[model samples]
Target: MTSRTAQNGGHYGAIVVGGGQAGLSASFHLSRAGIDHLVVEKKTAMHKWRDERWDAFCLVTPNWQCQLPGHPYDGDDPNGFMVKHEILGYLDRFKAKVKPPILEHTAVTAVERHAAGFRVETSAGSFTADAVILATSLYGTPSTPRAAERLPDDILQLHTVDYRSAEALPPGAVMVVGSGQSGAQIAEDLHLAGRKVHLATGNAPRCARFYRGREVVDWLWDIGQYNITIADDGMGKKRHDTNHYLTGRDGGRDIDLRRFAQDGMALYGRVKGVSGGRMLFEADLTSNLDAADRVYNGINALIDRHIAEKGIEAPPPSVYVPLWEPAEEPAELDLAAAGITSVIWATGFRPDWSFVGLPIFDGTGYPVQRRGVTAVPGLYVLGLPWLWTWGSGRFLGVAADAEHVVEHLTAAVAAPRQLMAQAG
Candidate 1:
């Protein structure tokens, strides 16, 4: 391999930002290609998985999908989901397997074009590399609605990132906003902990954990759903769609909010805002519930069709029936009167690319990349949802995207040096 080492204290053929699974996956393939690279992480390699998630957090998908390059899920339970510590153990094992050169506790502040290739400014020091891989996962800045500020100053509010357990909150009812995967699961976690939970449902879809005698994810894998690319016709819009709410906690099961309501957990619609010290909600609870069920059944129907076409024998398909229905849609709730003392915003996050000193972005501020390769030469993005396929964001597909990006980068890095050597 040709060494095009630019004059700098920290230089490499490639510099990968973020030490999460995505970054490590890239380093794995880069090493295979014999490229001299370094993985720069803002925190320890397993920081996010260790610190960001709640105590009860587990993989919503099955464990078989945890496919990092050269290191597949070696756990005994492929069908079972790995909980918080188990997930950390898996990642730790993968890190050891790849043995990538990594610098932890280093925050990358900026990346701009440089004469050599790209100049990366970090807390530890500056680095020059022939290529840059922004391996930061899809989540960037935690986002809570502006209305959260209007709530009475006394009511404690926390985003999902800060939530550890229901017992950690002060003794009182907890209101969880957003019905996405995080919201629904956290609500269940709190409800199961004997805490009164008021969940504000969103438009996020839901799906069954097991369907037709098999896991829904396994069925989807058979149908090649995970392989679907963003470029597929009519699939581009799916990139922004909220993930289907389910659970892998306690083995695995569907998170049925209806049953929770029947058991006494209060349910509300999407939060509108706080006014006059009362939380206001849109009167769309019934519709949102129905919408989620529709998606749930729709997926089952897809699986049934796939089974029929392939002549695969499976149990009879079953549709979800609403166990409980709201008699009246409550539009407003006085926080103090309801004894609500804490609010958990599972409203999700927005990508922050302000540090990237480049114009390769869309109107939405999302990086414009074709399966990890950016428009700008030698700049790429890895570990983003829908980067190339549906699994790009998760452990299921980061490896493929990383391998593709590293292949393209290695060729680009070698070309200039090869030409320069011939000229000399």
Candidate 2:
């Protein structure tokens, strides 16, 4: 790129790019540590969180768990899950409290390595800092599979990220791809809205928020799960582990699929490919359905253990069976005959790093860092779940991770920067 230089230079101690939860949390720590820094956010105050989320979306984590140091959630319903709006509100309020010198409505254009540090160029201006922390999230892109690209133009295909409401959907039947939370939720929603719905199920795994009537999070914690940070293969393991649980149920409560069957939603095995205005796949959804059952049993067992340990009198949750299942293989559902004109892909998301010009990323689009420390000097990450523990990167546990990262960043910038003193 162009040689790094700036004309109007008022040197900043550090610069943070992207003002998402990760960036804001890092900035919060920097402020508490007495570090003077500039935060460059691409959008207006908290727009990233507010504008991007779909309708009726609540954080997968409970409201009580949403927090940052000195800025924990203190709303009326602590136990309920916070919506995207509430989260955006909290971040804006936090930014105001810290008042980090942020320049909004400007996107980072390019970043070049300077002699002493790095030169960060933005829409509004250029800034030089001793360290640059990029807080752009992994969920930056909406990944559509290649097979989906071959779909006929007549059928409507939409990623879950872009889907807002049933009003946006065209008339006829709806076929939801993938069996993840979004797929289950959207399928359930569309079905209840009085549309013929076909759920193209794939590698689905059921989850329980509570098993045996005890919170699933508590069970995972008690069993020392999510603690496995830094697996043996490191980047390979991290990339492989990135995925969402298919079950919409949490704490043993039904989300979408539990009641979806009651609305006449049909379950089918994987969709192999689409051709001749028809979607072909094996009707033998036997193994896939079996896998779902296995997970249900496993979660129930965990709850049973919890009950036995606590000596609770209540019985386990009663299982609700699905309405219909495909019995044979290579089952073909003509998109036209099924009257399914639209496809909603709630399959899952994979991070894209085409814009991120850092060498620290692995092939699978995950950042290469050990507890947020990168091979590139002065490069650090915070607010990643399971960065050091299962909870480290999760909503409930991210505050502690942010605390650690802020502590480290403060030391990185404060211990040096003697040039300013000498120049003064």
Candidate 3:
């Protein structure tokens, strides 16, 4: 840990905002390049993994994917999934090894372009730097649908970030909105805990945890799926838009919506609106389910083709059949009659860049950058979805992306000095 007091109003070669994997990685590379930098964090390191996750939460990806810059996973169980504690431990060890200059509990309030390069205002104090790397993860704010406001006052609403466990929820049937990974897993958790779960299905893709005698993630990695950069112009847009629905339970398991339906989870299409204390759903539940099925099958087909082309021996295909019938879904669901006392919004999240006083954001509020390099010279962003590669935002890819960003930062820091020398 660096001296927080020393950083107050001090100038540096660069400043990395955020102390998670992305920030830590950036610090590592900057230090390695002999550049002076400080990593400012709002809370303790790996705050989200420590505080935001549920009790039973485990990484969907295998332990092998837990790759940091210098600290790679040399654990005994590479195929197993790491729980929350395990992840925190891994990060703690990485922080200890790297020993980057980090100021804990220091929150950045504002970032503005300054003559020195950038002026960063934080809870501690203000500092100027020649470069700034915004390493905050993509999902900074939990997003709930607008319809949530119209729900009855008696109905308790909690976003996925606020949800800790099923025991914390009120004793009644629960409606979990959004069928993404968190929603699906939470619905299963609530259902198993004796609560009737109503899941609003979305267009998230699903895949079996294991396929053809190998983990699906392993297969994807072997097929260079993670290495597919946005620059390739191949399935990058689609991959960036879609969220994969799988679970890290019972070693690893598939979480299809049909399975939840068969297990007594009331499945509905996207929640369209709310009126008269009644929730309205889209009538395209079957279509949404079919779309998910297509994605699942498509992944399997790709694996099959890879196996055939590579001459690798693999098990025969084990087809999955839909258990739920496609019937006319009710257009409206009465909240009172349904006995739903609580609503858990698993709708997902969006990045919060309100503190950044720069014109680098796009029309959609996402930062406009090319592979972490912002339009502004001294500004950079890391751990953002599709920032460079398909896995750019993930733990497995953050280190590599950080290295690339820091390389640019190195040259960015030198340009001014070179110009001054030339003029002299």
Candidate 4:
């Protein structure tokens, strides 16, 4: 649904959809640059951060890295992690601080490229705008496999978004599918909380916990490690998610896995099917897990040299032990023996633009764009992971990208604007 059109008048210079970080960044820049724009958020203000996360959620990034354009977090723990509530409050205060024209609870239903610019439609109302920026994240929608539909009713299956805390779960053995960040973290939490856990494996990259006396993420920015993708080869794009550098799902960012396995969490390659009160799991997660382990060692060596050369001295980082040995091939997991009950599918998410029938999307259903600018003039995307490079899609990295988008947003529609002199 959409909100009613502005009471005073017509199309805004720009309209931004979704009020998440990406949208906030874009909107904030537009505001500072003196652009008239509206930020439309469908859910309750900061609903994504407030509801989507478990209470224990803390940003993997230290507060120092949580900087946005024109505003940064002001707190004692700049070097510490920002919890979900902190982030939500920060955004809330940021929104209040800026007070940009925002339409809350009003969702954008359609955006047809109009000859003038773009015709926007929302539950509130409709108007034409010079451009539209989709900062709504690609992860807003939860993805479920076709196999999930076939799972019998006896098995309680829920996506990671539905998961709040271990207490949200019903009592029973649980199969936590997908071993990516959320999958691994959730499995570890539930297992440690005393639920029997089975993790379905898939391809995952890994990372090191610390490098040269600091959290590895610090090195990611300080040394411009992820920036390496700016000069990436054709091979890098194909393996964006699989690439070894940042793909490292090292538990150092979340929770350690060596300790996770020690708690009796069962590992499997992948989940193939489900029937009765059971689901089937395979043995393929080992290769990706092993690859992550190898990379961790490689990171250690790099960090070691940095320490010696730079005279960096501090407590040693915890050594990452590979939790599971290399599984030769697939093996079927019997839920009975595994003591599996509810299945927490912590698999990742992607965009749900299916309802948005726009020609701007390419073969992969991803918008074709150079940076955030799309092939369709007056249409743009912001906050997409790897939109330009490995770091382009991250929260810390979006500021540089937001500048690029704002520049285009301002210059592209310089004409027909109601100048301050003209307005009076």
TM-score of each: 0.96, 0.82, 0.95, 0.86
By summed lDDT, which 10 consecutive residues of candidate 4 come out lowest? 243-252
- Span of ten consecutive residues with least summed lDDT in model 1: 1-10
Best candidate, TM-score: 1
Ranking by lDDT: 1, 3, 4, 2
Per-candidate Cα RMSD to the true structure, in Å, reads 2.6, 4.8, 1.8, 4.2
**Clash count list over all predictions:** 0, 15, 0, 20
* Local distance difference test values of all predictions, in order: 0.90, 0.66, 0.86, 0.70
Cα lDDT for residue 341, candidate 2 = 80
lDDT of 4: 0.70
Q: Against the correct fold, how does model 2 do in TM-score?
A: 0.82
Q: Where does the lowest 10-residue lDDT sum fall in candidate 2?
A: 243-252
lDDT per residue for candidate 2 within 372-404, as digits (tens), equals 776766666665545666565555566666677
Instruction: Evaluate model 3: give its lDDT.
Output: 0.86
Pick by TM-score: 1 or 2, better one: 1
lDDT of 1: 0.90
* Residues 1-424, model 1: lDDT tens digits: 1112233467789998888899989988998999989888877886888988999999999999999899999999999999999999999898888887888777789999999699999887788989999988768889999999899989999999999999899999999999999999999999999999999999999999999899999999999998789999998877788999999988899988899999999999999999988999999999999999999999999999999999998888777889989999999999999999999999999877878998899988888889999999999999888888989989999999999999999999999999999999
> For candidate 2, what is the lDDT?
0.66
The digit string of per-residue lDDT tens for model 4 on 1-424 reads: 1232464226788988877777878877887888888887887655777777765666665677766776677778777777667787777776676565778888788888776688778887886788888887678778877778866666678888878777887777888787776777677667757787877767765566456467777665655555664336662363237433231223235354444666676667777786563566665566656766776777666666666667777566455666556434546666656655578887778787653546888777777777788877678888877777665666666777888999988887775455634886
